[model samples]
Target: MGDDHSAARPLRADARRNRERVLQIAQEALASDGLTISFDEIARRAGFGVGTVYRHFPTKEALFEAVLLGRIERFVADARALATAEDAGRAFFGWFARVVEQAAANQALCDMLDGGSQAGPQVGLRPGSTLADDFGAALGRLLARAQRAGAVRADLTGRDVHDLLRGCLTAERRSLARGGAVRMAEVFCDGMRARTY
Candidate 1:
Protein backbone atom coordinates (compact mmCIF):
# COMPACT_ATOMS: atom_id res chain seq x y z
CA MET A 1 0.00 0.00 0.00
CA GLY A 2 2.88 2.39 0.83
CA ASP A 3 4.54 1.61 -2.50
CA ASP A 4 1.24 2.15 -4.33
CA HIS A 5 0.75 5.48 -2.58
CA SER A 6 4.29 6.54 -3.39
CA ALA A 7 3.78 5.61 -7.06
CA ALA A 8 0.54 7.62 -7.16
CA ARG A 9 2.36 10.71 -5.87
CA PRO A 10 4.04 11.31 -9.21
CA LEU A 11 0.70 11.08 -10.98
CA ARG A 12 -0.79 13.56 -8.56
CA ALA A 13 2.11 15.94 -9.13
CA ASP A 14 1.68 15.67 -12.89
CA ALA A 15 -2.05 16.25 -12.53
CA ARG A 16 -1.41 19.36 -10.46
CA ARG A 17 0.99 20.70 -13.06
CA ASN A 18 -1.52 20.03 -15.85
CA ARG A 19 -4.24 21.81 -13.90
CA GLU A 20 -1.99 24.83 -13.28
CA ARG A 21 -1.01 25.04 -16.94
CA VAL A 22 -4.64 24.79 -17.99
CA LEU A 23 -5.60 27.56 -15.61
CA GLN A 24 -2.75 29.77 -16.84
CA ILE A 25 -3.81 29.28 -20.45
CA ALA A 26 -7.45 29.78 -19.58
CA GLN A 27 -6.72 33.09 -17.84
CA GLU A 28 -4.79 34.39 -20.85
CA ALA A 29 -7.46 33.21 -23.27
CA LEU A 30 -10.31 34.60 -21.22
CA ALA A 31 -8.53 37.92 -20.72
CA SER A 32 -7.81 38.21 -24.42
CA ASP A 33 -11.06 36.79 -25.82
CA GLY A 34 -13.58 36.96 -22.99
CA LEU A 35 -15.70 34.01 -21.80
CA THR A 36 -16.81 33.07 -25.31
CA ILE A 37 -13.48 31.38 -25.92
CA SER A 38 -14.07 27.62 -26.14
CA PHE A 39 -12.59 25.00 -23.87
CA ASP A 40 -11.06 23.34 -26.89
CA GLU A 41 -9.17 26.54 -27.54
CA ILE A 42 -7.97 26.65 -23.97
CA ALA A 43 -6.86 23.02 -24.16
CA ARG A 44 -5.01 23.66 -27.40
CA ARG A 45 -3.31 26.70 -25.93
CA ALA A 46 -2.33 24.75 -22.81
CA GLY A 47 -1.05 21.86 -24.96
CA PHE A 48 -3.24 19.49 -23.01
CA GLY A 49 -5.91 17.09 -24.18
CA VAL A 50 -9.50 18.31 -23.92
CA GLY A 51 -10.18 15.43 -21.57
CA THR A 52 -7.55 16.72 -19.17
CA VAL A 53 -9.14 20.14 -19.12
CA TYR A 54 -12.56 18.64 -18.45
CA ARG A 55 -11.15 16.29 -15.87
CA HIS A 56 -9.84 19.27 -13.92
CA PHE A 57 -12.56 21.87 -14.50
CA PRO A 58 -15.71 19.94 -15.53
CA THR A 59 -17.35 23.19 -16.73
CA LYS A 60 -16.45 26.54 -18.21
CA GLU A 61 -17.94 28.31 -15.20
CA ALA A 62 -15.72 26.25 -12.93
CA LEU A 63 -12.67 27.12 -14.97
CA PHE A 64 -13.61 30.78 -14.94
CA GLU A 65 -14.16 30.78 -11.20
CA ALA A 66 -10.83 29.09 -10.70
CA VAL A 67 -9.12 31.74 -12.78
CA LEU A 68 -10.90 34.53 -10.99
CA LEU A 69 -10.08 33.11 -7.58
CA GLY A 70 -6.44 32.67 -8.54
CA ARG A 71 -6.22 36.28 -9.63
CA ILE A 72 -7.89 37.51 -6.46
CA GLU A 73 -5.55 35.43 -4.35
CA ARG A 74 -2.55 36.96 -6.07
CA PHE A 75 -3.95 40.43 -5.52
CA VAL A 76 -4.48 39.63 -1.88
CA ALA A 77 -0.87 38.55 -1.61
CA ASP A 78 0.20 41.77 -3.26
CA ALA A 79 -1.87 43.82 -0.85
CA ARG A 80 -0.32 41.99 2.07
CA ALA A 81 3.15 42.70 0.75
CA LEU A 82 2.29 46.37 0.28
CA ALA A 83 1.00 46.51 3.84
CA THR A 84 4.60 46.06 5.00
CA ALA A 85 6.05 49.00 3.12
CA GLU A 86 7.65 51.79 5.14
CA ASP A 87 5.64 54.49 3.41
CA ALA A 88 2.10 53.53 4.21
CA GLY A 89 0.59 56.13 1.91
CA ARG A 90 2.80 55.20 -1.00
CA ALA A 91 2.12 51.52 -0.49
CA PHE A 92 -1.63 51.97 -0.43
CA PHE A 93 -1.72 54.31 -3.41
CA GLY A 94 0.76 52.19 -5.32
CA TRP A 95 -1.33 49.08 -4.80
CA PHE A 96 -4.42 51.02 -5.81
CA ALA A 97 -2.73 52.10 -9.04
CA ARG A 98 -1.61 48.56 -9.73
CA VAL A 99 -5.12 47.24 -9.27
CA VAL A 100 -6.47 49.90 -11.58
CA GLU A 101 -3.89 49.02 -14.22
CA GLN A 102 -4.80 45.38 -13.92
CA ALA A 103 -8.46 46.24 -14.28
CA ALA A 104 -7.69 48.33 -17.32
CA ALA A 105 -5.88 45.39 -18.85
CA ASN A 106 -8.53 42.82 -17.85
CA GLN A 107 -11.93 44.40 -17.54
CA ALA A 108 -13.63 41.10 -16.87
CA LEU A 109 -11.39 40.45 -13.91
CA CYS A 110 -12.12 43.93 -12.61
CA ASP A 111 -15.84 43.28 -12.81
CA MET A 112 -15.49 39.99 -10.95
CA LEU A 113 -13.43 41.53 -8.17
CA ASP A 114 -15.65 44.54 -7.92
CA GLY A 115 -18.43 42.11 -6.94
CA GLY A 116 -21.11 44.22 -8.47
CA SER A 117 -24.58 42.66 -8.46
CA GLN A 118 -24.19 41.81 -12.13
CA ALA A 119 -20.88 40.04 -11.65
CA GLY A 120 -21.57 37.89 -8.57
CA PRO A 121 -23.39 35.12 -10.38
CA GLN A 122 -21.04 35.13 -13.35
CA VAL A 123 -17.91 34.79 -11.21
CA GLY A 124 -19.36 32.30 -8.67
CA LEU A 125 -18.29 34.50 -5.78
CA ARG A 126 -20.85 34.81 -3.06
CA PRO A 127 -20.64 37.55 -0.46
CA GLY A 128 -17.96 37.01 2.20
CA SER A 129 -15.88 34.35 0.51
CA THR A 130 -12.56 33.66 2.20
CA LEU A 131 -10.76 35.26 -0.70
CA ALA A 132 -12.85 38.41 -0.41
CA ASP A 133 -12.36 38.57 3.31
CA ASP A 134 -8.61 38.16 2.99
CA PHE A 135 -8.46 40.90 0.43
CA GLY A 136 -10.55 43.17 2.60
CA ALA A 137 -8.39 42.53 5.64
CA ALA A 138 -5.27 43.37 3.71
CA LEU A 139 -6.79 46.57 2.39
CA GLY A 140 -8.07 47.44 5.82
CA ARG A 141 -4.60 47.14 7.26
CA LEU A 142 -3.13 49.34 4.60
CA LEU A 143 -5.81 51.95 5.03
CA ALA A 144 -5.50 52.00 8.78
CA ARG A 145 -1.74 52.34 8.59
CA ALA A 146 -1.95 55.20 6.15
CA GLN A 147 -4.52 56.94 8.29
CA ARG A 148 -2.47 56.46 11.41
CA ALA A 149 0.52 57.94 9.68
CA GLY A 150 -1.57 61.00 8.86
CA ALA A 151 -0.99 60.40 5.17
CA VAL A 152 -4.64 59.63 4.50
CA ARG A 153 -7.88 60.95 5.87
CA ALA A 154 -8.96 59.30 9.10
CA ASP A 155 -12.55 59.28 7.89
CA LEU A 156 -11.83 56.94 5.03
CA THR A 157 -12.78 53.30 5.44
CA GLY A 158 -11.98 50.12 3.57
CA ARG A 159 -15.30 50.33 1.77
CA ASP A 160 -14.40 53.82 0.60
CA VAL A 161 -11.15 52.53 -0.78
CA HIS A 162 -13.05 49.79 -2.59
CA ASP A 163 -15.42 52.32 -4.03
CA LEU A 164 -12.56 54.42 -5.28
CA LEU A 165 -10.99 51.41 -6.93
CA ARG A 166 -14.35 50.61 -8.50
CA GLY A 167 -14.28 54.10 -9.93
CA CYS A 168 -11.11 53.08 -11.71
CA LEU A 169 -13.00 50.14 -13.20
CA THR A 170 -15.71 52.48 -14.37
CA ALA A 171 -13.08 54.65 -16.02
CA GLU A 172 -11.60 51.62 -17.75
CA ARG A 173 -15.02 50.43 -18.93
CA ARG A 174 -15.68 53.81 -20.47
CA SER A 175 -12.52 53.24 -22.53
CA LEU A 176 -10.79 56.15 -20.91
CA ALA A 177 -7.62 56.85 -22.92
CA ARG A 178 -4.27 55.46 -21.81
CA GLY A 179 -2.99 57.03 -18.56
CA GLY A 180 -6.47 58.35 -17.86
CA ALA A 181 -7.07 55.78 -15.17
CA VAL A 182 -3.72 56.54 -13.58
CA ARG A 183 -4.61 60.19 -13.48
CA MET A 184 -7.92 59.30 -11.89
CA ALA A 185 -6.07 57.21 -9.34
CA GLU A 186 -3.84 60.14 -8.59
CA VAL A 187 -6.87 62.36 -8.10
CA PHE A 188 -8.34 59.79 -5.70
CA CYS A 189 -5.10 59.62 -3.74
CA ASP A 190 -5.06 63.36 -3.47
CA GLY A 191 -8.60 63.38 -2.20
CA MET A 192 -7.78 60.78 0.41
CA ARG A 193 -4.80 62.65 1.77
CA ALA A 194 -5.19 64.31 5.14
CA ARG A 195 -5.66 68.04 4.83
CA THR A 196 -3.75 70.60 6.88
CA TYR A 197 -4.85 74.16 7.44
Candidate 2:
Protein backbone atom coordinates (compact mmCIF):
# COMPACT_ATOMS: atom_id res chain seq x y z
CA MET A 1 0.00 0.00 0.00
CA GLY A 2 1.26 3.48 -0.86
CA ASP A 3 1.98 5.84 2.04
CA ASP A 4 -0.37 8.82 2.44
CA HIS A 5 2.00 11.82 2.25
CA SER A 6 -0.89 14.29 2.33
CA ALA A 7 -1.58 13.50 5.98
CA ALA A 8 1.95 14.57 6.90
CA ARG A 9 1.71 17.91 5.11
CA PRO A 10 0.35 20.99 6.94
CA LEU A 11 -2.70 22.73 5.57
CA ARG A 12 -2.00 25.55 3.08
CA ALA A 13 -2.52 29.09 4.36
CA ASP A 14 -5.73 29.47 2.36
CA ALA A 15 -6.97 26.09 3.55
CA ARG A 16 -6.21 26.99 7.17
CA ARG A 17 -8.15 30.23 6.81
CA ASN A 18 -11.02 28.38 5.17
CA ARG A 19 -11.12 25.84 8.00
CA GLU A 20 -11.23 28.58 10.65
CA ARG A 21 -14.03 30.34 8.78
CA VAL A 22 -16.05 27.14 8.54
CA LEU A 23 -15.55 26.46 12.24
CA GLN A 24 -16.73 29.96 13.17
CA ILE A 25 -19.82 29.63 11.02
CA ALA A 26 -20.54 26.19 12.32
CA GLN A 27 -20.24 27.36 15.94
CA GLU A 28 -22.75 30.16 15.41
CA ALA A 29 -25.14 27.83 13.64
CA LEU A 30 -24.82 25.20 16.31
CA ALA A 31 -25.48 27.77 19.04
CA SER A 32 -28.68 28.90 17.36
CA ASP A 33 -29.84 25.78 15.47
CA GLY A 34 -28.35 22.98 17.53
CA LEU A 35 -27.08 20.09 15.46
CA THR A 36 -29.85 20.44 12.91
CA ILE A 37 -27.98 22.98 10.81
CA SER A 38 -26.67 21.46 7.62
CA PHE A 39 -23.24 21.68 6.06
CA ASP A 40 -24.69 23.42 3.01
CA GLU A 41 -26.05 26.18 5.20
CA ILE A 42 -22.76 26.50 7.04
CA ALA A 43 -20.85 26.77 3.79
CA ARG A 44 -23.28 29.42 2.53
CA ARG A 45 -22.94 31.43 5.74
CA ALA A 46 -19.15 31.13 5.64
CA GLY A 47 -19.08 32.47 2.08
CA PHE A 48 -17.45 29.30 0.89
CA GLY A 49 -18.25 26.31 -1.28
CA VAL A 50 -19.72 23.09 0.15
CA GLY A 51 -16.66 21.18 -1.03
CA THR A 52 -14.38 23.38 1.03
CA VAL A 53 -16.42 22.79 4.16
CA TYR A 54 -16.51 19.08 3.50
CA ARG A 55 -12.79 19.00 2.78
CA HIS A 56 -12.12 20.59 6.14
CA PHE A 57 -14.64 18.72 8.28
CA PRO A 58 -15.52 15.55 6.35
CA THR A 59 -18.62 15.00 8.49
CA LYS A 60 -21.14 16.93 10.53
CA GLU A 61 -20.08 15.12 13.69
CA ALA A 62 -16.47 16.03 13.06
CA LEU A 63 -17.39 19.68 12.73
CA PHE A 64 -19.52 19.59 15.85
CA GLU A 65 -16.73 17.91 17.79
CA ALA A 66 -14.33 20.67 16.83
CA VAL A 67 -16.82 23.35 17.86
CA LEU A 68 -17.71 21.58 21.08
CA LEU A 69 -14.05 21.18 22.02
CA GLY A 70 -13.46 24.89 21.59
CA ARG A 71 -16.50 25.75 23.69
CA ILE A 72 -15.42 23.36 26.44
CA GLU A 73 -11.96 24.88 26.48
CA ARG A 74 -13.48 28.33 26.90
CA PHE A 75 -15.63 27.16 29.81
CA VAL A 76 -12.65 25.50 31.45
CA ALA A 77 -10.66 28.67 31.17
CA ASP A 78 -13.48 30.70 32.71
CA ALA A 79 -13.81 28.28 35.60
CA ARG A 80 -10.07 28.37 36.24
CA ALA A 81 -10.03 32.15 36.23
CA LEU A 82 -12.98 32.34 38.57
CA ALA A 83 -11.39 29.84 40.92
CA THR A 84 -8.88 32.49 41.88
CA ALA A 85 -11.49 34.99 43.04
CA GLU A 86 -11.53 36.16 46.69
CA ASP A 87 -14.98 34.81 47.51
CA ALA A 88 -14.88 31.12 46.75
CA GLY A 89 -18.62 30.52 46.99
CA ARG A 90 -19.45 33.56 44.96
CA ALA A 91 -16.94 32.60 42.34
CA PHE A 92 -18.28 29.06 42.05
CA PHE A 93 -21.89 30.10 41.90
CA GLY A 94 -21.10 32.91 39.53
CA TRP A 95 -19.45 30.54 37.13
CA PHE A 96 -22.36 28.17 37.53
CA ALA A 97 -24.87 30.89 36.71
CA ARG A 98 -22.87 32.07 33.73
CA VAL A 99 -22.55 28.56 32.35
CA VAL A 100 -26.23 27.77 32.79
CA GLU A 101 -27.27 30.98 31.06
CA GLN A 102 -24.87 30.36 28.18
CA ALA A 103 -25.86 26.71 27.91
CA ALA A 104 -29.54 27.57 27.90
CA ALA A 105 -29.00 29.96 25.03
CA ASN A 106 -26.79 27.51 23.17
CA GLN A 107 -28.99 24.89 21.53
CA ALA A 108 -26.07 22.60 20.77
CA LEU A 109 -25.18 22.35 24.47
CA CYS A 110 -28.78 21.75 25.47
CA ASP A 111 -29.15 19.05 22.83
CA MET A 112 -25.87 17.37 23.73
CA LEU A 113 -26.74 17.26 27.43
CA ASP A 114 -30.21 15.97 26.64
CA GLY A 115 -28.56 13.03 24.91
CA GLY A 116 -26.97 13.08 21.51
CA SER A 117 -27.20 15.65 18.76
CA GLN A 118 -29.65 15.48 15.87
CA ALA A 119 -26.85 14.07 13.79
CA GLY A 120 -26.79 10.70 15.61
CA PRO A 121 -27.31 9.03 18.96
CA GLN A 122 -23.60 8.46 19.44
CA VAL A 123 -22.59 12.10 19.11
CA GLY A 124 -23.28 12.98 22.75
CA LEU A 125 -20.68 13.78 25.41
CA ARG A 126 -20.10 10.70 27.47
CA PRO A 127 -18.96 10.47 31.08
CA GLY A 128 -15.26 9.70 31.68
CA SER A 129 -14.40 11.09 28.25
CA THR A 130 -11.59 13.57 27.90
CA LEU A 131 -13.85 16.56 27.29
CA ALA A 132 -16.21 15.56 30.05
CA ASP A 133 -13.34 14.85 32.42
CA ASP A 134 -11.70 18.18 31.76
CA PHE A 135 -14.93 20.10 32.29
CA GLY A 136 -15.77 18.09 35.40
CA ALA A 137 -12.33 18.55 36.90
CA ALA A 138 -12.46 22.30 36.53
CA LEU A 139 -15.93 22.49 38.08
CA GLY A 140 -14.90 20.09 40.82
CA ARG A 141 -12.08 22.33 41.91
CA LEU A 142 -14.50 25.22 42.31
CA LEU A 143 -16.93 23.08 44.25
CA ALA A 144 -14.22 21.83 46.59
CA ARG A 145 -12.93 25.29 47.23
CA ALA A 146 -16.41 26.52 48.00
CA GLN A 147 -17.01 23.67 50.38
CA ARG A 148 -13.76 24.33 52.15
CA ALA A 149 -14.84 27.91 52.63
CA GLY A 150 -18.13 26.70 54.11
CA ALA A 151 -20.07 28.09 51.21
CA VAL A 152 -21.48 24.89 49.79
CA ARG A 153 -22.80 21.93 51.70
CA ALA A 154 -20.20 19.49 52.93
CA ASP A 155 -22.25 16.53 51.80
CA LEU A 156 -22.23 17.52 48.17
CA THR A 157 -19.71 16.11 45.75
CA GLY A 158 -18.63 17.21 42.31
CA ARG A 159 -20.97 14.67 40.72
CA ASP A 160 -23.89 16.15 42.61
CA VAL A 161 -23.03 19.62 41.37
CA HIS A 162 -22.80 18.29 37.83
CA ASP A 163 -26.20 16.63 38.10
CA LEU A 164 -27.77 19.75 39.54
CA LEU A 165 -26.44 21.88 36.70
CA ARG A 166 -27.71 19.35 34.18
CA GLY A 167 -31.14 19.44 35.77
CA CYS A 168 -31.18 23.24 35.59
CA LEU A 169 -30.26 23.16 31.94
CA THR A 170 -32.99 20.61 31.19
CA ALA A 171 -35.57 22.60 33.10
CA GLU A 172 -34.62 25.77 31.30
CA ARG A 173 -35.07 24.02 27.98
CA ARG A 174 -38.58 22.84 28.84
CA SER A 175 -39.88 25.83 30.77
CA LEU A 176 -42.17 28.22 28.95
CA ALA A 177 -41.28 31.17 31.18
CA ARG A 178 -38.53 33.58 30.20
CA GLY A 179 -35.38 33.65 32.36
CA GLY A 180 -36.30 30.21 33.65
CA ALA A 181 -32.65 29.14 33.61
CA VAL A 182 -31.59 32.01 35.83
CA ARG A 183 -34.33 31.23 38.33
CA MET A 184 -33.46 27.57 38.40
CA ALA A 185 -29.80 28.27 38.94
CA GLU A 186 -30.54 30.70 41.71
CA VAL A 187 -32.71 28.21 43.54
CA PHE A 188 -30.20 25.43 43.02
CA CYS A 189 -27.34 27.46 44.35
CA ASP A 190 -29.31 28.56 47.38
CA GLY A 191 -30.18 24.99 48.16
CA MET A 192 -26.57 23.90 47.83
CA ARG A 193 -25.42 26.36 50.45
CA ALA A 194 -24.11 25.12 53.78
CA ARG A 195 -26.65 25.02 56.59
CA THR A 196 -25.87 26.37 60.04
CA TYR A 197 -27.75 25.02 62.99
Candidate 3:
Protein backbone atom coordinates (compact mmCIF):
# COMPACT_ATOMS: atom_id res chain seq x y z
CA MET A 1 0.00 0.00 0.00
CA GLY A 2 1.26 3.49 -0.85
CA ASP A 3 1.80 5.86 2.08
CA ASP A 4 -0.53 8.90 2.17
CA HIS A 5 1.53 12.08 1.90
CA SER A 6 -1.22 14.58 0.94
CA ALA A 7 -1.70 15.87 4.49
CA ALA A 8 1.56 17.78 4.52
CA ARG A 9 1.14 21.46 3.56
CA PRO A 10 3.39 24.42 4.20
CA LEU A 11 0.91 26.98 5.57
CA ARG A 12 0.92 30.34 3.81
CA ALA A 13 -0.62 33.65 4.85
CA ASP A 14 -2.15 34.33 1.44
CA ALA A 15 -3.63 30.87 1.29
CA ARG A 16 -5.07 31.42 4.73
CA ARG A 17 -6.77 34.60 3.51
CA ASN A 18 -8.44 32.79 0.64
CA ARG A 19 -9.63 30.00 2.92
CA GLU A 20 -11.07 32.51 5.39
CA ARG A 21 -12.94 34.27 2.61
CA VAL A 22 -14.28 30.95 1.45
CA LEU A 23 -15.49 30.12 4.93
CA GLN A 24 -17.20 33.52 5.27
CA ILE A 25 -18.91 33.25 1.91
CA ALA A 26 -19.91 29.66 2.51
CA GLN A 27 -21.34 30.63 5.89
CA GLU A 28 -23.53 33.33 4.36
CA ALA A 29 -24.74 31.05 1.62
CA LEU A 30 -25.60 28.33 4.11
CA ALA A 31 -27.30 30.81 6.42
CA SER A 32 -29.39 32.15 3.58
CA ASP A 33 -30.12 28.85 1.86
CA GLY A 34 -29.54 26.23 4.58
CA LEU A 35 -28.80 22.79 3.13
CA THR A 36 -30.04 23.95 -0.27
CA ILE A 37 -26.96 26.14 -0.80
CA SER A 38 -24.80 24.56 -3.46
CA PHE A 39 -21.05 24.37 -3.45
CA ASP A 40 -21.13 26.07 -6.85
CA GLU A 41 -22.79 29.10 -5.35
CA ILE A 42 -20.32 29.17 -2.49
CA ALA A 43 -17.42 29.04 -4.95
CA ARG A 44 -18.92 31.80 -7.08
CA ARG A 45 -19.51 34.08 -4.10
CA ALA A 46 -15.97 33.49 -2.84
CA GLY A 47 -14.43 34.26 -6.25
CA PHE A 48 -12.99 30.78 -6.29
CA GLY A 49 -13.67 27.65 -8.26
CA VAL A 50 -15.25 24.56 -6.83
CA GLY A 51 -11.69 23.25 -6.76
CA THR A 52 -10.70 25.78 -4.10
CA VAL A 53 -13.61 24.74 -1.91
CA TYR A 54 -12.83 21.09 -2.47
CA ARG A 55 -9.20 21.72 -1.68
CA HIS A 56 -10.10 23.40 1.59
CA PHE A 57 -13.04 21.11 2.32
CA PRO A 58 -13.02 17.86 0.38
CA THR A 59 -16.73 17.40 0.97
CA LYS A 60 -19.68 19.76 1.44
CA GLU A 61 -20.33 18.25 4.85
CA ALA A 62 -16.81 19.14 5.97
CA LEU A 63 -17.42 22.76 5.04
CA PHE A 64 -20.79 22.61 6.75
CA GLU A 65 -19.21 21.12 9.85
CA ALA A 66 -16.83 24.07 10.06
CA VAL A 67 -19.67 26.63 9.81
CA LEU A 68 -21.69 24.80 12.45
CA LEU A 69 -18.73 24.61 14.79
CA GLY A 70 -18.40 28.36 14.49
CA ARG A 71 -22.07 28.84 15.33
CA ILE A 72 -21.81 26.58 18.36
CA GLU A 73 -18.68 28.28 19.62
CA ARG A 74 -20.14 31.75 19.21
CA PHE A 75 -23.43 30.69 20.74
CA VAL A 76 -21.79 29.32 23.86
CA ALA A 77 -19.46 32.29 24.13
CA ASP A 78 -22.49 34.56 24.11
CA ALA A 79 -24.17 32.45 26.76
CA ARG A 80 -21.08 32.65 28.97
CA ALA A 81 -21.06 36.39 28.52
CA LEU A 82 -24.67 36.52 29.61
CA ALA A 83 -24.23 34.42 32.73
CA THR A 84 -24.51 37.51 34.86
CA ALA A 85 -27.24 39.07 32.81
CA GLU A 86 -29.67 41.36 34.69
CA ASP A 87 -32.24 38.60 34.87
CA ALA A 88 -30.96 35.05 35.15
CA GLY A 89 -34.09 33.41 33.80
CA ARG A 90 -34.32 36.01 31.11
CA ALA A 91 -30.75 35.32 30.15
CA PHE A 92 -31.41 31.61 29.79
CA PHE A 93 -34.70 32.08 27.99
CA GLY A 94 -33.29 34.72 25.69
CA TRP A 95 -30.36 32.54 24.71
CA PHE A 96 -32.71 29.63 24.10
CA ALA A 97 -34.89 31.91 22.03
CA ARG A 98 -31.91 32.86 19.88
CA VAL A 99 -31.22 29.17 19.22
CA VAL A 100 -34.87 28.59 18.34
CA GLU A 101 -34.75 31.45 15.86
CA GLN A 102 -31.70 30.00 14.13
CA ALA A 103 -33.35 26.59 13.91
CA ALA A 104 -36.51 28.22 12.63
CA ALA A 105 -34.59 29.85 9.81
CA ASN A 106 -32.34 26.88 9.09
CA GLN A 107 -34.30 23.72 9.50
CA ALA A 108 -31.71 21.79 7.58
CA LEU A 109 -29.20 22.30 10.36
CA CYS A 110 -31.29 19.85 12.32
CA ASP A 111 -30.40 17.15 9.83
CA MET A 112 -26.77 18.09 10.27
CA LEU A 113 -26.09 15.31 12.73
CA ASP A 114 -27.90 12.59 10.84
CA GLY A 115 -26.68 13.73 7.44
CA GLY A 116 -23.08 13.93 8.53
CA SER A 117 -23.35 10.38 9.77
CA GLN A 118 -24.78 8.99 6.54
CA ALA A 119 -22.93 7.16 3.79
CA GLY A 120 -20.96 9.97 2.22
CA PRO A 121 -17.50 11.48 2.28
CA GLN A 122 -19.02 13.86 4.84
CA VAL A 123 -20.06 11.13 7.21
CA GLY A 124 -17.16 12.18 9.43
CA LEU A 125 -19.33 15.00 10.74
CA ARG A 126 -21.78 12.87 12.71
CA PRO A 127 -23.61 14.78 15.46
CA GLY A 128 -22.29 12.50 18.19
CA SER A 129 -18.86 13.07 16.68
CA THR A 130 -16.42 15.91 16.11
CA LEU A 131 -18.65 18.82 15.07
CA ALA A 132 -21.32 17.93 17.59
CA ASP A 133 -18.69 17.33 20.24
CA ASP A 134 -17.32 20.81 19.66
CA PHE A 135 -20.76 22.22 20.32
CA GLY A 136 -21.20 19.94 23.30
CA ALA A 137 -17.88 20.92 24.81
CA ALA A 138 -18.70 24.59 24.46
CA LEU A 139 -22.14 24.03 25.90
CA GLY A 140 -20.73 22.15 28.86
CA ARG A 141 -18.83 25.21 29.96
CA LEU A 142 -21.82 27.49 29.47
CA LEU A 143 -24.32 25.17 31.08
CA ALA A 144 -22.22 24.82 34.21
CA ARG A 145 -21.89 28.57 34.45
CA ALA A 146 -25.56 29.21 33.78
CA GLN A 147 -26.65 26.63 36.31
CA ARG A 148 -24.38 28.04 38.98
CA ALA A 149 -25.84 31.44 38.29
CA GLY A 150 -29.35 30.04 38.55
CA ALA A 151 -30.07 31.01 34.93
CA VAL A 152 -31.08 27.65 33.52
CA ARG A 153 -32.73 24.82 35.37
CA ALA A 154 -30.46 22.47 37.29
CA ASP A 155 -31.57 19.20 35.71
CA LEU A 156 -31.11 20.17 32.08
CA THR A 157 -28.18 18.81 30.09
CA GLY A 158 -26.51 20.14 26.97
CA ARG A 159 -28.17 17.39 24.95
CA ASP A 160 -31.49 18.88 25.97
CA VAL A 161 -30.64 21.97 23.98
CA HIS A 162 -29.83 19.87 20.93
CA ASP A 163 -33.02 17.86 21.32
CA LEU A 164 -35.12 20.99 21.83
CA LEU A 165 -33.58 22.69 18.80
CA ARG A 166 -34.29 19.62 16.71
CA GLY A 167 -37.92 19.67 17.75
CA CYS A 168 -38.21 23.39 17.11
CA LEU A 169 -36.61 23.02 13.69
CA THR A 170 -39.03 20.23 12.82
CA ALA A 171 -41.97 22.36 13.92
CA GLU A 172 -40.69 25.39 12.06
CA ARG A 173 -40.27 23.39 8.87
CA ARG A 174 -43.85 22.15 9.10
CA SER A 175 -45.10 25.63 9.94
CA LEU A 176 -43.27 27.22 7.01
CA ALA A 177 -44.53 24.47 4.76
CA ARG A 178 -48.00 25.58 5.79
CA GLY A 179 -47.14 29.29 5.33
CA GLY A 180 -47.48 29.91 9.01
CA ALA A 181 -44.94 31.08 11.63
CA VAL A 182 -47.54 32.59 13.91
CA ARG A 183 -47.11 32.03 17.68
CA MET A 184 -44.81 29.10 17.06
CA ALA A 185 -41.85 30.94 18.50
CA GLU A 186 -44.01 32.14 21.36
CA VAL A 187 -45.00 28.65 22.34
CA PHE A 188 -41.45 27.42 22.04
CA CYS A 189 -40.10 30.29 24.10
CA ASP A 190 -42.76 29.78 26.73
CA GLY A 191 -41.79 26.16 27.08
CA MET A 192 -38.19 27.16 27.78
CA ARG A 193 -39.21 29.36 30.65
CA ALA A 194 -39.01 27.86 34.14
CA ARG A 195 -42.10 27.22 36.14
CA THR A 196 -42.91 29.62 38.98
CA TYR A 197 -43.09 27.66 42.23
lDDT of 1 by residue, 97-159 (tens): 787767666656876777835454758435588877898898899999999888899998998
User: What's the candidate order when arranged by decreasing TM-score?
Assistant: 1, 2, 3
Misplaced by over 4 Å in model 2 are: 1-11, 114-119, 176-182
lDDT of 1 at 48: 81
Q: In model 3, which residue pairs have backbone atoms overlapping below 3 Å?
A: none
TM-score of each: 0.89, 0.85, 0.70
Q: List, residue by residue over 7-109, the lDDT tens digit for candidate 2.
A: 5345576688889999999989987787888999999999998999999888898999788778767888999898878999999999988888788777677
In terms of lDDT, model 2 sits at 0.81
Those runs of model 3 whose alpha carbons end farther than 4 Å from true positions after fitting are 1-11, 34-38, 113-134, 137-158
Compose the digit string of candidate 3's lDDT tens values, residues 1-103.
Answer: 1334433333456578778998898777876787668889899999998998888888787887777667666766777777666666666667766766675
Worst 10 residues of 1 by lDDT: 174-183
The TM-score leader among the candidates is 1
The local distance difference test score of each candidate is 0.82, 0.81, 0.67
